[model samples]
Target: MQFQFHPLTRKEATELISWRYDRPLDIYNIKVDTDSLQNTVDFFVDPKNSYFAISSDLHEFTAFCCIGADAQVPGGDYSLDALDIGLGIRPELTSQGLGSPIAIATIDYAKQSFSPQRLRVTIAAFNFRALKVWQNLAFLPVQRFRKQNGGNEYLVFIRNT
Candidate 1:
């Protein structure tokens, strides 16, 4: 599918707040208090977050992406000069072979937008589906670590841009 990316909007952020994923992958769901929709909306709409909404058909919201610090997970070694990438494919769209294209597009976007020397991604260890996609893009394993809050294990991957 052809892809178009644009700055995230309040309406899109509001809709994303309702996207729920199944177990294992459910960890990607937004975790803010549902009572304060404004808080979550503010996150995606904020200029510093670098959030972008993705779509092919004008009427469909395919995915959302973020670059930079907001894309980095806590407790990861972010000392490198790589722009991080964060993406979420609509729950129903997962495992349907869409990740690679979206990811390639995201990397191209990151290059033209950030021009970082490298790129980085931190993913949940159990998310082999995502890991495989990143690996296919040549994002190599850097390290495996738990968050300072001490939750599930996560692996960090990096690749030269």
Candidate 2:
């Protein structure tokens, strides 16, 4: 399926604030508190960042992804210069074999938009599905560390762009 990306609008950001995934998947959902929403809106509006709403050929929202440097992930200096990618599938679309496509689309976007030497993704250690998706995309495990906020362990993966 073909995917098209567009700037995330204010209305889309508001709708995202109320999006909630199912039980286990909810753990990976973006925090929708007032502060978080404000930050998200600010990030989305920044042209320097590549945060966007991805839509299918039918113009239905399929996922959200940021393919730039604004992603905060636990890692070392090696990631500082790499294009970082963060993504979330629509709550209703999770586990329907969409992960790989979403990841590929984001990576393709990063490659086209930034032309970075490398691409990096930080995945929660327990999020096996996401890890698998990165692995499938040829991202190699680089490091494992704990997030300062929640102390949850995460793994950093990277691949040459």
Candidate 3:
């Protein structure tokens, strides 16, 4: 499957907020309360943030990706020079063997567009699937820490660009 990346729009952001996942993965769900709707939209639409929507040849929204400072979850020491990134597939698509292609596409897109020195990604410690995928891609574990509110443990992985 070929993936096309495009700047995320306000409409896509709102659509993304509606995506819900099963247990474990549910932590990724984005919620925009009424009061924060505007701010949420602002953060997603701003070009400086590198928020993007990924689609397939059919033009259906398969996933979303974000890179740089915005992708950093709180509590991780991001002082290292690496392009941080995050990727989420639509709920129904999980565990369907699409991870490698989607991830490869996202990595390629990030490398071509950002020209970063290296790439880093943070994953919830419980998400073994993602950890395995990144490891298979040669990303090694670099650090681990709790979320900002002292939530679940998170692992940071890095791979050279």
lDDT tens string, model 2, 1-161? 88888888777766666779776667666686675778877767676776788889644777888776656564434435777888988787878898998789888987887788989888888889999999999999988888877667888898998
TM-score, model 1 to reference: 0.94
Best by TM-score: 3
Candidate number achieving the greatest lDDT relative to the actual structure: 3
Ranking by TM-score: 3, 1, 2
Worst ten-residue run, lDDT, model 3?
57-66
How do the residues 33-85 of candidate 1 rate in per-residue lDDT, one tens digit apiece? 85777887987899898999989763378988999899887888888778899
The best-first sequence of candidates by lDDT reads 3, 1, 2
All predictions: root-mean-square deviation over Cα?
1.4, 2.3, 1.2
How far off is residue 107 in model 2, in Å?
Answer: 1.0
CA deviation > 4 Å runs, candidate 1: none
1-161: candidate 3 lDDT, tens digit per residue: 78999999899988888899999899998877999988988898899988999999744888999988888989999999999999999899889887878889999999999898899999999999999888999999999999998798999999998
Name the better of 1 and 3 by TM-score.
Answer: 3
| TM-score of every candidate relative to the true structure | 0.94, 0.86, 0.95
